[model samples]
Target: MSLDLTCPYCQQPFQLAGEQPGKHANCPHCGKQFPIPASEVRLSRKVDQEPVPQRIAPATFWYVQTEDGRQFGPVTEGQLQAWYEEGRITANCQLLRKGADQWQWATDLYPDLHQIGEKKPQGAAAAKPPPPKQALDRPALPQSAAPITPLSPDDFPTTGAGLKSLGPVLRPLPPGYGEPRLHSFEALEDRRKFAPFMVAHMNRPPLNKMLLVLGIANFVVGTLRAVLYFALFLGLLGAIGAVDERGDERVANRAAVSLGIAFVMFVLNIFVISGGVGLLQRKEWGRSATFAGTLIGMIIQLTCVCVTMMLGADGSGLASAIWIVLLVLLLPSILYDAFAAATLTLPSVVTDLEE
Candidate 1:
C-alpha cells in the first residue's frame, strides 16, 4: 500500500510506500520535502481538506534619541540596523523598543547587529594583542568592594606628610556614562535672537552702502537747491518793492506768484533733505520716507515721459530722438531707486532695525 503526504510549502499531494510512513520524502509534483502520513491517518483525511493557516508574530519597532536630544520614533529594527551600519547612529545612542518603559545603549541591546572581525589563525608567529574589552563586557564590581565615601580636604595634599599618608583612592564613575552631553536650549534660543543682527552688521552688503551714499548726495543737492530758492525769494521780494507805482499790474502779479512758488519749493526741499539724512542713518522711518520720495519721483518722471512721447509724435525726427534720449538717461535713476527700496526691505536689514 502507498501512503499519501501533503507538502507544507507547495500544498501538493504525493504518495510513498507504506513502509515509508512517518518518514520525510520529496513530493513528486512540487519536488518539496514532506513527512509521509501513516496509512490510518491518510485514510481519515479527505482530498478536499482546507490548508491550515500558520501563525506569525507582528514586526517590532524601536525609538532612538540623537546626540542633539532629538527623539526619533517608531522605527523598524531593520531601519535601525541600517542607520547603525551607515554611521548615522553610534554605539552610544539610546534605543527603546515599542512599549518598553526604559531605554538601553544600542551596543548593549543589540550586540548581534554589528559584525565581529575575523580572528587570526593560531600559528608559530607572534600573537596579536587581545581586543579591547567593550563597555558591555565589563563586569559590575561586587557590593563587597569598597563603598563610596564622601571626599574630605585631606584628599588633597597641602604638606609632604599629608601627601605621603594619602594612598590610591577608587571613586565611583558618574552616572550615565554613555549618555549625550547636556546642553541648554534656552541659551541657544537667546543667541539666536541676536544672530541675525550680528550677521547683518558683520557682512553689510555693498547695496546698503550705495543707498546710504545716494541719501547723502540727495541731502547735499537739496541743501544747495534750498539755498538757491531762498535767494530767489529774497530777490523777488526786492523786485516787487522796487516796482514803480505806475508799473503794469500784470508784471507785479507775476512776480508775487513766482515768489510764492519758490517759497513752497524751498519748504518741500527741506523735508526732502531730512528724509535723505534719515536714509543715510539706516533709520526705519528714513527707509519709508525715501521709498515715498522715490515713488513720487517715478510718477513725475512717467508723466513727463508720456507727455513728451505724445507731443514728439508729431514733431521733428530730431525732437523725437531727443525725447527718447532723455527717457533713456532717466532709466538709471529709476532703477537705483528700485534697488534701494528692495535693499532696505531685506529681512536682515529689517530685523536689525528697532520697531
Candidate 2:
C-alpha cells in the first residue's frame, strides 16, 4: 500500500510506501529532508468512491534571539532547523514560535534537532557507559609549617637601597609619547569646502580624454588639408607659368592671386593644427586660442550663409542647397565648441590648470 506524504519544507505532495512512522525522507522537488508525520498514512476505502486529499497548513514562523541581544525573525521551522543544522543557531540559543507566550532554549524545545543528519549507532557501543571514578585519598601534612601569605606591593622596598640593589633606573619616555596630535581646523575646513570640487576633478578625466581625441583628429585632418592645398598651389604655379608663356597676363595674374590665397590658407591650417595639439595638452592658452578661432569660423560661416542666400534669391538653387547642407553638418561642431567653452571655464578645470 502507498501513503500520500506532504513535504513539510516545500509543501510538495508525494507517494510513499507503507513505512515506519517518524522516518526521514528527502523531498524530490526541493531536496530538503523532513520527518514523515504519523498522521500522513493512506487509509483503505471503497473503490467506487474517490478519496479526498488532506490539506496540510503552512508551518508557524518562529523568532530567534542572538547572543548579542538582537532578535531576528518570523522565519519558518524549516529555516530555523536549517540554521540549527548549519551551526548558525546554537543549542543554547532562545527561540519563540508564533503565539507562544515565553521564549525557550532551542535544544530544550527541539531535543532531536541536533540528531537530524546523524546516524544512530547500533549495539552496546551506542549506549555510552559512564567512566568509573577513582579515589584521590592522601596522607595529611604536619601542622607545624605556617601557611604562605600572598605578597603585597608594600612587601617590596621603595628607597635608595632598593634601587641600588635593583641596578640602574629606567628613564621616563620623552614628551608627547602617546599624545593625540592636534589638527588645524582651517585645513580640515578647506578640505570640506573642496570635497565636491575634488570629485568633479576626478570625473573630469573622461571628458578631457574625449576632447584630446577630438583635438588629435582636428590636427590630423588640418595637416592633410594643408598638404593637399600645397600640392594644388604647385599645380597652380605650373598653370600660371603656362598662361604667361601664352601671353594671357590677366589669367596669369589671377593664377598668382589664387596661389597667394592657397598659401594663406596653408598658414592658417598650420596654426589651427598646432592649436589642436596644444589643446590636447590642456594648455589654458590653447583653449583661449581655439575658442577665438572657432568664433571667427562661425562668423565666417554666417557670412557665407548670408551670401549664399543672396545668390539663391538670384536663382542659384544648387549653391544655396549645398550651403544649407554644410550649415547642417557644422551644427554638431558648433554645439561641441559651446560645450567645451563652458566646461573649460568651470572652477574644477581652473583649479586643475593652476595646479
Candidate 3:
C-alpha cells in the first residue's frame, strides 16, 4: 500500500510505498527526513493497558440446521420451541447452538424438547384413517411439548451488549467451507453433563447480567480474603498465647481480643465465599449468604475503623495490623460489599436467582 504525504521542508506532495506511520521518511524533493505523525496512528497500543473486551454470543442460543444445508437463526430456547410446535423442525433434526461445534440432535441438546407439539383441534389428521404410504419411518410427533417461557423484553433490557436482541437475528452464515466447528471443546459424552450445566457456566445472571459476574467476583475475592484473614487469625492466636506467657498482661488481653475479632472476620469471609459458590449453583441460599455476609462484614469493619480512630492507637503490632486491615483491606471490601448487596436486590436479579 502507498501513503500520501506532504514534504514538511519542501511543501511538496509525495507518495511513499511500503511505509508505515511513526518512522522518519525522507522527503523526495528536499532529501530531508521527518518523523511521521504518531498522533494519527489509531492502531497503536500500549502493552501495559488491558486488551479490549470482546463480545461472546449467548451459549444457550441456537441455530436450526436445515436439511438443505442452509442454517437459520441465532435462535433462543423459546423461539426454538415455537418452531418445533409449528412443525418447522423435529426432535431428531440437527441443531447447532452458537458455541457448539457439531450439529446436535434436538432432543440430545434439550431433553425436554422431545418432538412434542400442541394437539390441533378435532379436525386434525388423527381423526382420519392414516394413509399407509410414507417416505420415512419417522414416529408421529406429539402435538405439543412443555411450553417454554423466555424472559420478556418488558422485564429485561434485551438490547444490551451482553444479551442478544429478543428478536432472533436471521443472518446467514458467511461463505466459507470451514467455520466455527473448527474447534469443539467437549466431545459427545462430555457434552451430556455440560449441556445441563451450561447456564451456570455462562457466568451470566438471569436476564439481569450482573448477578453472574457478581457471583464470580465474590467467589474469587471471598476465597482470597478468607485465606488472608484466616492466616492472620492463626498467627494472632500464637501471639496472644506468647504475649500472655512473657509480655505485659494488659497487652496480652488486648491481643486476645484482637484474636477474637480476627476469628469473626475469618468466619464472615467464609460465608461470603460460600454464598458465591451457592449463586454459581443457582441456589437461593448462595445469594442470601453472600449478601448477608457482605453487609455484616461491612458494618463490623466500619465500626472497627471508627473506634480505632476515635481512641488513638499506639505503635504496636495489633495497632499496625488494625491500620492495615482498616485502610488497606476493609475499605475496598466495604465498597465491594455495598455494590454486591445492591446488585443482589435488583428485581430482575432476585427473580432470576429465585426461579
Candidate 4:
C-alpha cells in the first residue's frame, strides 16, 4: 500500500510504502528528504502470530549502541520482528556481534539474513543432475537454382532406411535454450562472477600497507623523542651543580619540575604511538581515537612552538629544529588519515536477496 503523505519540510505529498520505511524517498516537488514508515500506509498487521509476535503499523527508529561501544543506524519495527524470528539477534540485547561483517540496520532486523538451515553446502548444491535436453528445429537451408544432389542408399550403408543405432548421447543446451526463455542463464552467470570481484576491489580498505608502515614509524619517533626529553632534563639538572650550592638547589628543583612535565608528554607520546598504529590496522576505536588525539596534539604542538618563539626561547637550536621537523612530518599525515577514514564508505553488505 502506498500512502499519500505531505512531507513536513516541503508540504508536498509523496507516496509512502510499508516496504520502504527509513528509505530516502523524497518529495518530487521540493526535494525535501522524507522517509516512508509502515504506519503511513495504514497497512501494518501481524503477518505471523504463532510466536506471540505483533507487527506494528509504523516502526520508529532508535540509535543502538553495540557491545563495542559503536553507535549503529536506526532500526524499524518490521526489522525488529524479523530479528526476533531469527536467532541471529536478540531483543534489547546490549552486545552486538563483532566482525565488520555483522550489520546494524535502521530496523533491528537483518533483511539480508538467511533463513535457518536454508544454506546448502556448496559442493552438494553443485552436484544436482543436469537439466533435460531441449529440442531444436532445423532451420530451412537456402534453395539454390541448381539440380538437387541426393545421396544413394549405399552412401549411408544403413541396415534400415535412414536409421542407425545410437552411438553416443549429446549434451543438452542449458536451461536458457528451452522454450519461453525469460532471460539468458549463461549471461546471468557471467555477470554474477565479475560483479562481486569488481565491487570488492573498488571498496577495498582505505589504508594500504604503506599507510600502516607510516603509522608505525610515527609511533616510534614520538616514543624516542619522549625518552630523549627525559634525558635532556636530567642533564640540565646536572649542569646547575656549578652554581653556588643554594642557587644550585633552586636550579635543580626547576629541572625536576621540567622533568615531571616532560614525563607527561612521554605518556601522551606512547598513547599516540599505540593508538595511531591501531587506527592504521583499522580497529574501530583505534581509528577514531588516534585521529582525534593526533588532531589535538597537532594543535598543541603548534601553539607551543608559537609561545616558545614569542618568549625569545634560548633552547639548543638543534633540539627545537628536530621537534619542528617531527611536527611537520606527522601533523599533515594525521589530518589526511583522519579525513580519509571518516569519509570512507560503509563497507558494503548484501543489500538485496532473490527469492
Worst 10-residue lDDT window, candidate 1: 128-137
Model 2: per-residue lDDT, tens digit, 102-160?
A: 56665565454333223323325334222111212223223323332322334322243
RMSD of 3: 32.7
Using all chains and alpha carbons, the TM-scores for the candidates as numbered come to: 0.33, 0.33, 0.41, 0.31
Write one digit per residue (lDDT tens) for candidate 1, span 29-112. Answer: 777676665764556454336577766456566667654445665655555544554455554456666555555665565453
Using TM-score as the yardstick, the better of models 2 and 3 is 3
Q: Runs in model 4 with CA error above 4 Å?
A: 1-206, 233-245, 248-254, 313-355
In TM-score terms, candidate 1 sits at 0.33
Off by over 4 Å in 3: 1-207, 315-325
Q: Which stretches of candidate 1 lie over 4 Å from their true place?
A: 1-183, 188-207, 244-247, 291-355
Error of 1 at 87 (Å): 47
lDDT winner: 3
